[model samples]
Target: MPALGGKIDMVPGRMHGLRVQAQREGRYRGQCAEYCGEQHARMALEVVARPPDAFDAWLAAQAGPAAAPANAQLARGQAVFLAQRCQACHAVRGVTAGGPGATLGPDLTHVGSRRTIAAGTLPTHAATLAGWVADPQAHKAGARMPATRTLDGADLRALAAWLESLQ
Candidate 1:
């Protein structure tokens, strides 16, 4: 499909695969050309193709832990994250959630550094993070993340700030 702007295919066993040479130094969006499930249209991906130097820098950052909270607000946000048991479903390297027995949702070690969140459903930013934390279902239908209505406005702000700092 011309709208997709990339070649895509799905092999047996429901595996979608595509290989595209790095053509630019920025993010490229793609979608599954093959329908695999009810939300096939919503399944999207982003490829961050950077120059060698930039790619190396990004790789190094991703290999590191989530950046430490810079302020008391961010620190409080980290605490709220831990308190809410968000670690169980996500992994932030050098953080308690990545310690042991962390079930895989997505490795959020350097999520803030990424271009998008929720499987490329939204841009990566504090506002997006807060919205996702507050109610993931609203952004992505059938998203496994449960709503966090329990978090008050203050905690939500702090948590979003902390996550945004994890670059």
Candidate 2:
């Protein structure tokens, strides 16, 4: 498919679906394609175009349980994440976070598999993820996420690494 441009006009009460196929394994970046709401500009899309086998493998991984932290640092990070109530908004299926109400935010079951985070506000990297986790409001205005100033740098790094390892 040709490159898709942002700024898609909305058709009220309509559900549109566009199907496209990727020929390679890579991350495809796009935008909302329509002005849906106030945050439309920040609404971005990241489609991971993986080969069939790789896609299946990723699917299997997502279907399975969230991996346990390999080291003490990651374990600490996970603990911090849970303690901070991050699970209240986001979800990492297979991992027992909060219940259904905790699923208010994004489904992070395969977040590490994506190319971007915060609806494409930042790249899916350790540094960016750490910053996002630290101060999401700074990056996106009127964001529901609150700043995690209580989490020190070390804990932030460990949490970021743990999130990145989700892939």
Candidate 3:
């Protein structure tokens, strides 16, 4: 997602480029303008434009380990994440050693910093995160993360909260 006035496209076996200025410091949301396929709706994008200093700080934070859990609930959530083998497909950088999930799935090192989830299909909030954790396909059909039928309501909330605090 480019700034309000920016746009770009990709073509098979071709190269292209476009330059656009970030008119303001904030987040911009956009979606593919062309018909891609059955799951085109899931092809969402977001652009976060920040001042040079802020951007640098953000980048530095991302390069470091995820923030530690601050509460008991969040701690439990972390446990659930590891016990459920979420590390098999997701990584929290310093929290989890490098593995397949580190490359295969979106990195969760700073997931809480994101403004949206499920490829922008839903807002980033604890409740939505919980739902997504329970059943990813429900939010984004054909998602790689299978529905988690083992977690109860409390555990789900804790897990989601933990992820939300990863920033």
Candidate 4:
């Protein structure tokens, strides 16, 4: 593992496979130095900060399918996703993301399959993702992705709802 604010090559099974023991408080972040792709700086990194019970609930939700809503909001959310250029850096398997000029960010192919979002700062929930989308910098200063503040109220709800459904 790299030292705080220091760069170090990640060697698997040695210092690379290291795991940070979960703390009862605070958060963390890091950058990959392998030149994996573009927007490496924009790649979100996080760790959970909730207590055990809350973490358990969030974990369960991530492990399961997205809950369905009875309105066309989710469809509208999909449209918003495309129109907003989210496909530029992320990929959603079975979806039309990951187009040309979009090899920089982490693959969101199985975002719903992920247990945490923004690396680990927030639980993989619609509300949390919506918040992150609205203002990434507020949660993680110096984030490469600018805040997508155009979303508000129902728009945020619908987009988050649709994203959560992608699981």
| lDDT digits (tens) for residues 82-102 of candidate 3 | 898888888887788776456
Off by over 4 Å in 1: 1-18, 97-103
Model 4 residue runs over 4 Å out of place are 1-8, 11-71
Per-residue lDDT over 1-167 for candidate 2, one digit per residue giving the tens place of the 0 to 100 score: 23433234447679866666666677777766555666677987766777789889878877876778889987887787788788888887766546866767887666776677888788897888888888888888767778888877888998888888777
17-134, model 1: which lDDT tens digit per residue?
Answer: 6556765566666777686764565677877777899779868877877788888998999999899999988888877636454655788878888778876788999999999989
lDDT of 4 by residue, 22-134 (tens): 44454555556576444445454545467888889867765553344446998878778778888787665545545685655566545755667765556888988798889
On the 0 to 100 scale, the lDDT of residue 55 in model 3 is 91
On TM-score, who's better, 2 or 3? 3
Structure candidate 4, residue pairs in collision: 46-119, 46-120, 47-120
Candidate 1 structure lDDT: 0.80
Give the C-alpha miss distance for residue 154 in model 2, angstroms: 2.2
- Candidate 3 local lDDT, residue 136: 84
lDDT of each: 0.80, 0.76, 0.83, 0.66
Residue 25 of model 1, lDDT score: 67
Q: Which of the two, 1 or 2, has more TM-score? A: 1
Better of 3 and 4 by lDDT: 3
Give the worst 10-residue stretch by lDDT in candidate 2.
1-10
